[model samples]
Target: MLPPSVFESAFNSSPIGKYLLSPTPEALILAVNDAFLKACSRRREDLLGKSLFVAFPADPDDPASSTNEAELRASFARVLETGTPDLLPVQRYPIPLEGPDGTIAFEERFWSAYSAPVFGPDGAVTCISHTTKDVTEQIRSERALRESENRFRALTTAGQVVYRMNADWTELRELDGRGFLRDTDSPRSFWLQDYIPDDEQARVHAAVGEAIRTGRVFELEHRVRRIDGSDGWALSRAVPICDAHGRVVEWIGAASDITERKAAEEKLRESDRRKDEFLAMLAHELRNPIAPISAAAALLQRMQLDEALVRRTSQIIARQVGHMTALIDDLLDVSRVTRGLVELERVPLDLRDVLQDAVEQVAPLVQARRHTLALELPSQATIVVGDKKRLVQVVANLLNNAAKYTPEGGCLAVRAGAQDGGACVEVSDNGIGMAPELTGRVFDLFAQAERSADRSLGGLGLGLALVKSLVELHGGTVGCESAGLGQGSRFLACLPCLSGDTAPQGEQDDEPMAQAPAALRVLVVDDNVDAAVMLAMLLEASGHEVLVEHGARAALARAHEARPQVFLLDIGLPEMDGKELARRLRAEPATRDALLVAVTGYGQDSDREQIMAAGFDHHLVKPVDMERLEAILAGAA
Candidate 1:
C-alpha cells in the first residue's frame, strides 16, 4: 500500500493541481500550489470533499463548458477502466476561472492536459496524475517558423540558388536545383578536396574552423565545382547549436549556389572598372570641347547682340551640351542593357540626315588631322524609319573608329547611297589596317586590337559594340570588311528603307569668325607646359603677340620685359596660385594699367567669385574658345 504521508507530502509541494474526486464527482479534495488555486479560482477548504461533479461541473445549459470537464472525465474514466495511456492531439480548454474582476484576462488561462494512471501493489488504479502545460507561445512560434522557411525558400529559388550545409563542412547539399552557376574551382571532388580552389582552401578552412570552435555563425564565399566538371561559385553561412550547459552541439547553415551570380558580380565589377576608364576618357574628351564651349559662353555673355553670331554661339552651346548628354547616356544605356531592360524609341528618320550630322560632328577632327574627307550621298533621298539618335550613333562610331585606326595623313571617305530596297552608309579609312584575327573580334565588348600598355590607340572597345547593339535595335545590320594587315577597313551599315519624304538638311554651314581683336602684347602664365603652349598658339592665331611664363614668379619677372596689356593666369599654378599672382601683378607699378584675366579649369561659381575677389579683373576656364578669348582681348584693349 502507498504511504498516506508520501501522498500528503506530494500534495503540499506539487506545482500542478491534484484533486481527490468523490463518487458523484461533486466536491473535491484539492492538493495544489498557489498557481493551481489561482487557475481554478478556489481556496483549499472550498474544494475539499465536495462532490467533484457538483463543485466543478460543466455548465449544464451552456454550450461552452469551463475546463474540458467532460473530456477530462472521459480520459480519467478510460485510465481507470483500462489502466492504459490515452494520447490526444493538442486541445484547448478555458479554466472557467476569473480574476478579482470576474472578467477574462491574460491569466484567465487555458491548459493542454495529459493524465496517467498510477497503480497500487494489486495493480488496482490508485490515483491519476494530470499535467497541464501552457502551449500558446510554443504553437505560435512553430507556425511562424514554418511560414518563414517557406518564404525564404521562395525568395532564394526565384533567382539565386540556396543550399543547406550539414553540421560538418564536408557536404554542401543543394536546396534548389537552379543549375545556373559559374564554377571556378575543380569539379572532381564532388565539391570537397577540389570544390574550393587551391588558392581559397586555406581561407575557407580557417573561417569554418573558427566558427565551429567558438560556436559562432560563419559566412563566406568561395570558388566551387559543379556536377558537370565545370568550375562555379558558392556563398555559404552556418549557425551553431549549444547544449543546456552552453557547449556547442551542432550547427545548421545555408548556402547559395551562385555560379551565374558570381559571373555577374565579376562582370559588374569589370563594368565599374570600365566606367572608371570611360570617365577618364570622358575627362579627356570633355577637355576637347570644354575649352571652346566655355570660351564661347563667356564670349557670348560679353558680346553685343547680332542675330547671326548669337544663333551661331547658341548652336555651339546646344551641340556641346548634346555631346555631354550623349556620353552620359551611353553609360546609362549600358547599365540598362546589363540589367535586361533596354527600351527602343522607333520613328521614321532619313538615314541621310544621320550621316550628315555625324560627318559634321567629326569635321573638326578631320581638319585638325589634316585628313581629306570625301562624302558621297545619293541624289535620291534615302529614308529609313527608326531611332534617329541610334542611327547617328552608328555613323559616329564609324567615324570615330576611322579616326583612331588611321594615321594623321590618312583619307576618310563616307558614302551614303541607296542599296537593294535599303539605305546603305559606308565609312572607309586608310592607316595601319587591322590584322585578320583582330578584324574578326572588332565588335566584341571591351575588345581592343592593340592592348599593349604603350599602344597609341585609346579606346575601351565599347564604341563599336555599342554602335552594333544600337543599330540592331533599330532594325539595321552593321558589318566590317578589311583587307589583311596594312590594308584599310570599311564599315557598312544597311537599314531597310520606307519610301518617305526627303531628309532635312542638318546644320552644315559655318558661322563667320568673330573678327580679330586689336593686337596687344599679352602674357600667358600656367604651370602645365602643354596648356600654356596651346593657349599661346591660340592667342597668336587670334593676332595677339604672346609671351609664356611657367609660374607666378616667372610671370612677375617676365612682366617687365613683355610690357603686356593683358595677362592670362592659371589658378592652379605651382608655388603661388593665380590669385596671388594677380594681386602681386597689380602691386607692380608697370602692370597697374594691365588687364588681369585668371585662366583655369575651375568653373564653379564660387571659384569665379574667389578669383574676382582676389584682384583678378576676369576669370576664364580652360579649353579656351577663340571667339570668347577675342572678345576678352577686345574688352581689355
Candidate 2:
C-alpha cells in the first residue's frame, strides 16, 4: 500500500542483499541495494539497464556454471509468471573478485535466495525483487558433525558399550540403543552396584564419585555380571561433561570386555611368585654347605692338631665339599636337560649289574643310618638297553632319597623284575611319607617335602627331577606314589627290555691294582695356591717329578723351560685364561705334543667341549678322584 518512491527507497537501503529486475524476457536489472552492490563487488552503473543474465552471466569455460545459472533463472521466471514468491534451496554461485595482480577471479560461495514479483497499478507484474543470504559456514559445520557421529558409531559397533548418565549418575542409558543394558533389565536408573560384582562395587562407586567431583576422567577395571549370569572382567572409562558455567551435567563412558587378558595377568603373577621362591630356596641350600667348609678351613688354619683330630676335620671338609659339588652338578644337569643338550648312551647291559652298582653306592648311607635293607632281584638277569652310568645314578639317587627321608632304623626295600617285556625297579621305604598334594609336585624342579626342625636331611630338591629327566632320556618312565603322610612312599622306574641275547660284556679285571708306569715330568697350573700345592705333593708322592705355578703367565714361561711331558692347566686364571694359554702352548713346538689336561671347577659338557677345542687331551673337574687321575696318567704313559 506504500507509494512507489517510498518502496523503492526502502528496498534500495535494506541490510540484506536485494535487486530489482524488469519483468521481461531479458529480465533487465533496474536497481540494487547497497548490500547487493557490495556482495557482488560491483557498481549500480555497471548493472543498471542491463539484463540480469548479462550483468552476471555463467562462465563460458565452466561446465557447471550453466546448470547453476539455469536453475536461478527458472526460479526468477516462475515468480514473474505466477506473481507469487519463490524460495530457492541453498546453491553454489561463484562471484567475481579482483585479485592483487589486477586479474578478475571467481570466488566460490553458497547462498539461500528468495524472489517475489512486484505488481503495478493494473496488477501486472512489473519487477522481481530478489533477496539472498550466504550460508557456506553453516553447511560446512553440519557436514563435520555428521562425520563425527559416523566415526563414533563405527568404534562402538565392535563389542563396546557406549553409555551416558545424568549429572548424579542415576539415569543411565545406552546412547546407541544397542541393547547393552538388556542384561540389567534396561533399568532407567543405574548404579555401580547393579553391574559390578559385590566385591568391587564400592571401589567403582568411589571412583565415579571422585570423577564427578573433580570433573576428571574415570578409569577402572573390575569384574561384572553379564546378562547370561556369568562373571567377566571389564575395563570401563568415562569423562565428565560440564555446562558453560563449569557445572558437571552428565558423563559419557565406554566399557570393553577384558576377561582373557585378566586371566593371563594372574598366571604371570603366579609364575613370578614361584620363581622368587625358587631363588630364595637356592640361596638357602648353597649357604648350608658353604658354612661348614668355611668353618673347617678357618679352624685348620689357626691350629696344628694331632693326626687323629686333623684327619677328622679334613673328613668333615671333604664331605661338605662333596655335598656342594653334587649340588652344582645337579644344577648343571638341569640346565643341560632344559636346553636339550643331554644325549643318552644306549648300550645293552644287565639290569642286575646296574642294580648291584647302585646298591654298592648307597650301602654306606644305609649303614650310616642303620636302616635295614632288603633286595629282591630276579635270579635271571634282566637285560635292558640303557646307559649303565646314568642308570646307576638314577637308582643311587632314589636309594639315597629313601635313606635321607626315612628315620634312623627304618626299613627299606628294593625289588627288580621283568614285567610285560619291560624291566621295572621299585624302591620303597617306611619314610616320613608325603601328602597327596605334595606327591603330585614331588618331581617338580625345586620341590621338596617338609624337613625336620634342625634340617638334618638336607638336599637341593633336584634329585627326583634329575631322576625323571635321566630315565626319560633312556626311553623310560618314572613315577612316585605315597599312601599319605607318615605311611610310606614308593618310586618305580620302567624301561623297555631286550628280547634277544645281551651284547657281549667287556673283559672284567678281577686282579689286583696294576703298578703305575715310570713317572713323567708333570707341570701343574692353578690360581689357588693350596690346590696347586696339594696336587703337586700328591703327584710327587706318586713318584712323578712335578712343577706348580699359580699364574698362567708363570706357567707358560715354566712350560717352555721345562718342556714337561704333561701339563695340568686351570681354566680361570689372572691376565690369561687357561683356554688362551693352552692355545698358545699348543702353538709352541716345544709343548705342542705335551699331554694337555684341563683341571678346573667347570665340568659341564659344554665346558669339556671348550677345553678340548682349546687343545686339551682331557678335562677333569676340581677335586679330581685319585683313581681316575691314576688311570689317566697310566694311559698317557
Best candidate according to TM-score = 2
**lDDT per residue, candidate 2, 326-445, as tens digits?**
878888888776545676667788888888889999999999999999988888867888778789999998999999999999999999998777999999999998888777677777
- Highest lDDT scorer: 2
Query: Against the true structure, candidate 1 has what lDDT?
Result: 0.68
lDDT of 2 at 103: 63
* Pairs with backbone N, CA or C atoms under 3 Å apart (clashes), candidate 2: none
C-alpha lDDT of all candidate models, in order: 0.68, 0.80
Which lDDT tens digits does candidate 1 get at residues 233-293? Answer: 5566667767789876555655555555557568779677755665666566567567778
Off by over 4 Å in 2: 1-197, 224-233, 241-268, 302-304, 349-353, 374-384, 415-425, 449-454, 475-478, 492-518
Q: After superposition, how far is residue 336 of candidate 1 from its true place, in Å?
A: 18
Give the root-mean-square deviation of each candidate in angstroms: 29.0, 31.2
